[model samples]
Target: MEHSKIISAAMKINQLTDLNTYVIDNSGEFVFYHEDISIPAFMPGSGQEDVLNLYNQMMIQQMNQLYSYTNEWGLHYLGYSFSTNDSFAVIIGPFMYLTPDMYGLSREYNLRNNESEDLRSMCNQIQVLKTDKANSFASILQQFELLINKEAVPIRIVANKDNEKYRKRENNSIMNDDADIVTMRYKLEGNIMHAVEQGDKTTAIKLLNSNDMLFSFSERFPNQPLRRVKNLAIVLSTLLRNAVIRSDVPAIFVHRVSEKYAYEIEYSNQLSKLQQLYEGMVEEYTDLVIANTLTHYSKVTQKVIEYLISFYDKQIDKNELAELCFTHPSHLSRKFKQETNMTITGYQQMIRMNQAKHLLKNENISIEEIAWLVGYEDASYFTRVFKKETGYTPSQYRENN
Candidate 1:
C-alpha cells in the first residue's frame, strides 16, 4: 500500500479511538503524527528526542510484529512494524493499564524534585484502560496492519524485568516505613491546601486525585467504604473552607459553599457521584477565592464589593449602598474608585459582564434570555456592551470559543 493511504487509514483509526497515533518511516523519521490525546509535557517519554530514540531502537529490532511496551512509570504504548517496499511503523500510546501510583512513578522517573501537585496533575491526564479494552484496541491495530500490509502480525509483549524488580524493591521499602506514609499524607494535605488558597484549581484537583496513599479509603476502612469516603469528603470540605478563609474570602460565602457540599457528600450514595463532588467542591471553593478574596481592600470597600457580587443581577442604589457601609454616597464612591480603580457602577457592570460571559460559555440560553439573566433589560444594549467589552459579540464569542 502507498504510504499516504496507510497514513490516511491511521488517521481514521486515531479519530475512532481518540488515541495518539504516529507513523515513522524506515529511517526512523516521523512521516506523520496525530494526537487526539496528548502526552503531558512533564512525563519521561513525552519529549521528541526520547520518542525518536525509542523508535530507532524499535526499527532496528524486527518487522511484521505488533509490540506492547509499558514504561517504568506504568505508561503503555503499542507499536507495529511492516514493509511497504520499505519498513514503516504505527505507534499508539501513553495510556495506562491501571491507575498509576504517583509516589512510585515519581521515584521511577526521578521526579521527586518536581512539585507533587504538578506530577499528579500530569498523571491524572493519562487514560486508563482495562485489559479487555487494551486487547480490543490492539486487535483493531492488528487488523489495520493486515489490511494495509497484507501480512498478519504477531503480538509481542516486551517485559521490562528491570523495572519490575525496581518497582517491587521500592514498594517493599516504602510500604514497610510507617513514618514515610505519615509524612507523605501530611505533605500532600498541605500542598492541596496551598493550591486551594492560591486559587489554583488545576493543581488543587490534581493533588486531590493524585496521592493514593492519602486518598485511598479501602485500606483504612476495609468494609465501610461509603462511610470512609464520606468521612474523607467531610475532612476535605473543612480543609478547603479554612484555606478559603485564609485567602480572605468572606466567611459567609465560604460557609454557603462548604455547607452545600457537606450536605451533598453525606446524602450522595454513588462513589462516582462523590468523586465528582470532590472535584466540584475544590472548584467552587477555589472560585470563591478568585471571585471574593478582598485582602487588599479596606473593610468598607470589601463590604461594598461583597454586596455588589451578591446582587450583581439586581439594580444598585448608591444611597442604599452608602447607608449599608455607614457612609455618604459621594465618599463611598470616591473610596471605591480609589481602592479598585473603577467607579461603583463600573465595577458592578464588570461583574455583570463577567457573569454574562460565564453564562455564554456554559449555559444554553438565548441571547435575550442571557441579557435578562445578567440584569440587562435590553438585549441590543447588552449586545453592544458585550461586544465593546470582549471585542467579539456574544454569538461570535460563543462560536469562536
Candidate 2:
C-alpha cells in the first residue's frame, strides 16, 4: 500500500530524532504508531492522556491556522505537525529533561507485571533522554515545512481513471479562466474596497462569498495547483493594503497587518485554507477601518464619518448628516469637535484629502476628476481648499509628489 512509505518515514523520524511519532486520520484516530518506546514508559512520569493531549492539541491548532502547529508543554515537551496525505500526523516531542526528574517513574501496569521476568526486563530498559527544545523545534519546523509544500499523494490502492479525468477537468477549469474573469476580479475588488472604506461589513462579506477567484496556469507549472491561488492571495494582499491606506488607517497598522497576512499566504499550502484566509483578510481589514474611524467619535459623529467615507463622491451638508444621525446638526458638530479636536468640516476634508492623495499617486485621472472624486464640484474652488490644507494647489501637489 502507499501507506508503507509514510509509515517507514515516520518510524525513521522516531528513531533518529527520539520523538514519539504517530499518524492519525481526519477524525484523529491513530493509523500508525511507532515502536521506538514502550507505551507505558513513553513519556517518563506522564500517562497516555498527557502524551495524547499533545497530539490532540497539534491537530486542533493546525486545523485553525494555515501553517504547521507547534507548542511547548509540561515544561519539557514540544509538539509539531507534519504532512500526511492519508491522514494527519504530529511528532510529539523531544523531551528537554536533562535528568531523570520524575520521567523515570514506572507505569503502574509495568509494576503489576514485574513478577514476569520479560515484563520486568522491558520495564528496566526505560531511560530518560535529554534534548534541546529550541533546536528540536527548529529542525521539526524545517522538515515539516518541506513536507507540506510537496504536492499531496493520496493513500488509495489504485487510480479510478474516469474519476481522475473528471477531477483534472475540474481543476483545469479553475485555472484557465478567460476575459469575463478579469471583469469579475475588478468588480469584486472594487466592491470589497468600497464596502471596507464605508464600514459596510455586510456587503463586503457578501461580495467575498459571491466571488470564487479563478487562477491562471502555464504549461510548466500546470500541475502545481496552489501556485496561482497563492499568487492571487499576494495580489489581493497588495490591493487590500492600498485600500486600507486610502481609508485613512494608520500607516504602521496597515503595514504590519498586511505583512503578516502576506507572509502567511507565502507559507500556506492548502486551497481551503487559502480561501478561508482570503475572505478573512478582507473582513478583518474592513473591521480595522471601521474601528479606526469609530474611535473617540460619538455614535452620531461615527455615523457622519461613515457617510463621508461611503459617499465622498457627492456634496455633504451638516443638516443632512444630522438627520441621518437623528440629532441636531449643531449638537453633532459640537460633540465631533470636542471628541476629535477638529471641526466636522475639517475632519471630512481630511478624509477627502486622503482619498485624493491615493488617487493622485496611483491613478491617471485628471485633477478635476480627482476633485470630483473626493466630493468637490467646483474645480477652481477645490484648488483653493486644497491649498488651505496642504499649502499647495491640486496641480502643484500632483506635480511635486
TM-score of each: 0.47, 0.43
lDDT of 2 by residue, 1-401 (tens): 25555556566556666655665555777666754444343323344454465566556543312222211212233444545444355444424322221211222223322233333333333332333544554355335334434543322111112234223433453333355456546756765776677677766776666455333334325687688778877887777778788889999999889888988998888978987887788887888888887886677778777776665656568898888889898898888888888887787788788778766765556888677657676888888888998898877788887
> Which tens-of-lDDT digit does each residue in 35-105 have in candidate 1?
64544566756665435645666688877666766555666777777776888878787677555565555
Give the C-alpha miss distance for residue 24 in model 2, angstroms: 63
Which pairs clash (backbone N, Cα, C closer than 3 Å) in model 2?
none
Query: Clashes in model 1: which pairs?
Result: none
The candidate that wins on lDDT is 1
Every candidate's CA RMSD? 17.3, 23.3
Error of 2 at 156 (Å): 56
